[model samples]
Target: MHLRQFNKAGVEAFRRFLEACRENPKEPVPVDLLESHEHTVLTSKQIVVEPREFSSRRQAADYFQDLLSPIPPDAVRKDAGIWTWLSLFYFDQICPTGNGNRKVRNDYTYIYMPDESRYFYRHLLFIAWQVKQVAPECNRLFLDSSLVTLDKLTTEVFKRLYLTRIPCLFELLDRLYWDCSNNRPAKGIVSPHKISAGDLVHRFPTRIRQLEKTYDLQSLDADQLLEILGDEFRQRAATSQSQMELSMQ
Candidate 1:
């Protein structure tokens, strides 16, 4: 009866309402919907999504430029600029933006410098979730300075809790890099090649290459994470629809 989001069940419920409107034509709106002002909440909140866009590597290099702000972009150091850049974009893309009907996706793109051969599409859900929790105000601060309003102090306190509990998951990323580097074994004894740890590129693939799909892999790759999320959303929608149909019957 909540009908919070418009899945198949919510749709069916809406159809029933419309049918009632046709059949009775004079009855007051359903209490479950008219009980509050939340009926149109989604419409007011939905951000319009634009067409997806791609970008070149040189452009990516500029956006990922090292931040000179109070917090360093490369928190783990060793100049993981690409990883840092990807994390932000990736977090923003992990889910469809809207809660109902066509959750808008972010239009984002980036590329590697010089080579420009590989283009990476990123979705940084964990990072976004962390920021949403720890420093949400900071997350939306946007460096404008003028936008820092004190209206969200309570939310900010929770944001602080989020970061403390998660630590932004940097250590976990470090271990992932270590694993990716060791997996190849450097084609046997990679020393004497003047390769530093910084030279190693940590490549997470588009799928769950080896690990089983579980909470254990909260930060493996964007695509797999999105897949898990998509499945969950689908299952929840199906359940809701089933419940709504059951109730009407």
Candidate 2:
């Protein structure tokens, strides 16, 4: 179907629908509300969006990036209506019905809150799309999980403004966490105590902050950053690389 954006009335209607869904999670989404032309207008840049299941957030991001390429970046970013509409379009994936119920979270998780900077990053689709646009290289580390999961690693990395903007930081994260053989993040990286003393969840960002104070991190690439990291990270990187080599043999 052609891409569309909700009008102000449409957004309000969507909000009301969400409230109802929260009250009765088993209630099916109204097809009429989703398809009503009066509630939504065609997008300025016409693009077809078919109903499809995405294996991972990475795939979904890539799909959206390609589909929305015709529209200006700023236009896409600022348009809350379009994103909210997309959320409704893929409601089943985001809030799957299982065992006669759907576990819907806070409204912000599905609806794009453009005016509220604090909640802006909470929208699942918007955040996935934004992260892919900003840090394409870290997709394996960040977006490899199923569309519904908002993993700790992704939350930790993206919440930090400095981390998101730096190309070197993305490279460092990829080297440290991404499992090349499996094409997924290294196991236990996200758990605070699961990996080791200094895990990605608890220590990586703090360590980077400390390093930033003492060094011009922007000037350093991933290799240099690796050398500067504590033994915990270096050892893990070494172990991962060794395993990768062994797997290839």
- Give TM per candidate: 0.18, 0.89
Candidate 1 residue pairs in clash (backbone atoms < 3 Å): 57-111, 90-123, 90-124, 91-124, 91-125, 133-159, 134-159
Residue-level lDDT tens digits of model 2 in 1-249:
788888888888888888998899877786566568878988854698989788888888998998899998888888988999999999998888889888888888888987786777778998888888887774677777778867777777776777776668777777777776776787777785664545777778788889889988878888888898889889878777877787789
Global lDDT scores for all candidate models: 0.29, 0.81
lDDT of 1 at 127: 26
How far residue 245's Cα lies from its native spot in candidate 1, in Å, is 60
Name the candidate that leads on TM-score.
2
Best by lDDT: 2
Candidate 1 C-alpha error for residue 128, in Å = 8.4
Off by over 4 Å in 2: 35-38, 179-183, 192-195
lDDT of 1 by residue, 157-214 (tens): 2223222343433332222222232222122112334433322221122122233344
Task: Give me the displacement of residue 29 in model 1, in angstroms.
Answer: 32
